[model samples]
Target: MTGHTKAHTMVGKSSQSLPKRILHSGVILYVALAFLALIYIMPFIIQVATSFKTDADATANPVSLIPQVWTTAAYSKLFLNSDFPVWFKNSFIVTIVVTVGRVFFDSLAGYALSRLQFRGRDIIFAMLVAVMSVPMVVLLIPKFLIIKSLGIYDSYAGMILPLLIDASGVFIMKNFFESIPRSVEEQAMIDRAGTFRIFWQIVLPMARPALVTISILSFQGSWNELSHFIVSTQSSSLTTLTKGVASLASGQLSSGNQYPVKLAAAVVMTIPVAVLFFIFQKRIMNSSEGSVKE
Candidate 1:
């Protein structure tokens, strides 16, 4: 009886300590995560601070998160005295059109590759994989030549069209579509729904996660694209944010470092992409939940 009582007491103590152990572990994990988050976020914080600083202050205290003297001179110059607005407009146009086109065309191609069994289907997929393996830098000359040959050089079409379809986006969608049960489509067929109707109503709607992923990537890629825009456009009126910012960073504007102005441009360029990621973050999280449930 005494031994059993002692054993029960020990068990009770262990049970009582379990919650404390778990709480301690949770605190440690949270601390580690917070530290890592700060590390990643420090650069942006410094950028924002630097943007509000004068050129000399920024250069002097480059790593400082708190500016000694804050000013909006950089922003004022960007908005009023420079071509930033034109660059913003061009980026907006190209990003929107390219994102929409990529979502639609990529989904279409993915569906065809995933569901439709036709002759040379494997060959076509192989070709797509091979194309994806090739470095994008190698295609720069070819792309420029094609744009020049087509007489679309130095135009919005030149900037937007080349980025409309992405091999990776198609691959993502195709893999996603393949993960979906064929019985879902078979049931739609049993109801006598046409292929296009089924794809539009059922498959596409179910592919919300993949579509959102593609949309985010497409928008970010097209917005930050520099090389394509450089080779495609020579006209200042057609300059996108990346090119405009590059020129600013490279001393197109008067003189030394210009850290304040350059950092301001970097911060501004990051906002849209950051907003996009936050907006879709919930959906992205839920996508994982959905995959697990499936």
Candidate 2:
């Protein structure tokens, strides 16, 4: 009886200590995470601070967290004198069209591949995998050739058409479809719904996280796309933000080292993605967590 009582007392002591050990571990983890987060965010902090500095101040205080003398000269030139607005508009248009197209077309293709019973589905999937394996840079010349041959060079069609379908988006949608239980789709089919109807009204609506992923990725890609636009269109009026910014970077239209203008352009280019990110922060976080597991 005495030994049993001592053993029970020891068990009680361990149980009481368990929560304290967990709490201590959690505190250490929190501190480590905070340190890592600061390291990751420090660059953006530096970029924002440096963007406000004058050319001399920026150059002198390369790593300073605060600018010595703040100025807006670069931004003024970018907006008022330069063609930044045209480039901004072009970027906006391309991003919107590409995001919408990829979401719709990619989901459609993914759904068909996942759930449909059709001839050549396996062949189509194999081709898609092969196509996805082809490096994007290698296709630059071929895409330009196709755009030129189609007589859409230097136009919006050339800018938008080749980007309408993306392999990554298709892959994301396909994986998301597979995650969902097949019973939901089967029930819809039992109710005599057409495949397109079932996919549109049923499965797609359940794929909010994947849809957000596709939208964000597509928007970022199309907005920041440089090389494709460089080869697709040659006219200044048709120049997207990426191409225009490259010209600015290489001293095409500006005379001096306009660091402020370039930084402001970078900041402006980042806003849309930033807004979308904040708007869908939860979904983005969940999607990120999900992808990490894969």
Candidate 3:
């Protein structure tokens, strides 16, 4: 009887301790995640803080969050006293065009690959996957030569056309389209709907999440692009935000380091894409969800 009582007491102790152990583990996990989140966001926080600081303060206390003298000189210079507006206009134009084109083209290509029967479909997809593996840097010279040879260098066409559709965008669309059930299309076909009609009326509507995801990625990619702009265009009038901000980095438009101005430009460059990401954050992740409806 004494031994049995002791065993029961030990069992009771373990049962009581289990909840405490789980709580302890949960606390540690949350702490680690919070710490990592803080580290990741620190640079963006610093950029925003430095944008409001005076040039001297930015240079001296570069890492500090608090500005010794907060001023709007940097923002004022960019908005009123510089070509920042022109750069913004150019980037907006290009980003809009590219985003729209990529979504339309990617969706079409993705649907074709997912649903349409063709002879070289597999080979084409394999080539696209292979192209994705090749570094963009390696293709810079060839891209520049082609743009020049096509007589579109230093023009908006050169900048926007080549970036209209990408392999990854097509790949993403294809995967999402595949997740959709064929019964949907088969029913449409029984109703005497044409292929294009079925795709437009049914498949595309069901792909709202993936389409939004494509728009976000395309907008962000085109907005942040620099190298392609460098190799494709040269005129100051055609400068995008990425190229203009890069010029700021090299002190081309300022006397001193002007960290504030540079960071301010960087901040402005970030806002649109950040807003887009936050707006569609949920949809971007599970874009292919519910594709196979019962």
Candidate 4:
């Protein structure tokens, strides 16, 4: 009886401590996450703040959250007296086309690899996996050579064509499609519906999460792409924001520690990507919803 009482007492003690332990752990976890968030957001905050400051204020107080003097000279210059608008137009054109093309083409390729049975499908899939492993730097020269040979160099075709599909995107879509119940497609097959019809009407709707995910990635990737643009084009008229912003950051146009002008351009460049991510954050990696019986 005495031993049982002592054992019960120990259990009671542990139970009492559990809440305290949980509270301590929660506090620690929140503190760590908050610290990390601050680190990540600090640079962006500084960029926005400095964008409103003059060159003198930016240089003197590089990390200041509040500018000593706020003015829109940098923004006015970027909008009014520069080729920044043209660069943005090019970026939007390339980004929109690349995002749409990647989603459509990658979906087709991924569906084929996942659902269709063919003799050499396995070999093609393997080759795709291998391509993903190859560093993009190694392919840069080859990409340039191919673009030049195709006679699309120094043009939008060269900029947008090579980026329409990626191995990782294909892999993502294939895996997602395979997870969807095969019975869904079997029903369409019984109805004498074609493969394209089934994919377009039924399968695509269910794969919303994957589609949104890849579209975000493709948009951001193409928007920020530099090396490809560097190799593909030379005309100033065809310059994208990535190339133009790079020049801004490098002080190619603005001279002598003009941090506000540089950072202002960077700030503007990030707005589209930031908005895209927030709008789609809820759909990212969500479980695919479909009706399938056990």
Pick the TM-score winner.
Answer: 3
lDDT of 4 by residue, 1-294 (tens): 999999999999999999899888798789889999999999999999999999899998999999998899999989887789999999999999999999999999999999999899999999999999999989999999999999999998999999999899999999889888888888799999999999999999889889989999999999999999999999999999999988887888766887888888899999999999989898786654533464
Q: Report lDDT (CA) for all predictions.
A: 0.90, 0.83, 0.93, 0.92
Q: For model 2, how does the per-residue alpha-carbon lDDT over 1-294 read when each residue is reduced to its tens digit?
A: 999999999999999999899788798789889999999988777777767878787767777988877777767778899999999999988889988999899999899888888999899888889998998899998888899999999999999998999987888888788777777777778889998898889888878888888888898889889989988999989988888888877878666666667767777877888888888767852434323222
| Winner on lDDT (1 vs 3) | 3
Q: Which rank order by lDDT, best down to worst?
A: 3, 4, 1, 2
lDDT of 3 by residue, 1-294 (tens): 999999999999999999899788798789889999999999999999999999889989998999998898999999998899999999999999999999999999999999999999999999999999999999999999999999999999999999998999999999998888898888889889998899899999889888988999999999999999999999999999999999999999868989999999999999999999888898883854745766
Evaluated at residue 207, the lDDT of candidate 3 is: 91
Clashes of 3: 0
Question: Considering every candidate listed, which one attains the maximal lDDT?
Answer: 3
For every candidate, C-alpha RMSD to the true structure in Å: 4.1, 6.0, 3.3, 4.2
Better of 2 and 4 by TM-score: 4
Provide the lowest-lDDT 10-residue window in model 1: 285-294
- Full candidate order by TM-score, most accurate first: 3, 4, 1, 2
Against the correct fold, how does model 4 do in TM-score?
0.91
Model 4 clashes, total count? 0
The stretch of ten residues in a row with the least summed lDDT in candidate 4 is 285-294
Deviating ranges (above 4 Å) for candidate 4: 1-25, 288-291
| Candidate 1 lDDT, 1-294, residue by residue in tens | 999999999999999999899888798789889999999999899889899998888878899888898699999988998999999999999999999999999999999999998999999999999999999889999999999999999999999889989999999889888877787777789999988898899888888889988999899999899999989999999999999999998899778989999989999999999999998876752345224222
TM-score between model 1 and native? 0.88
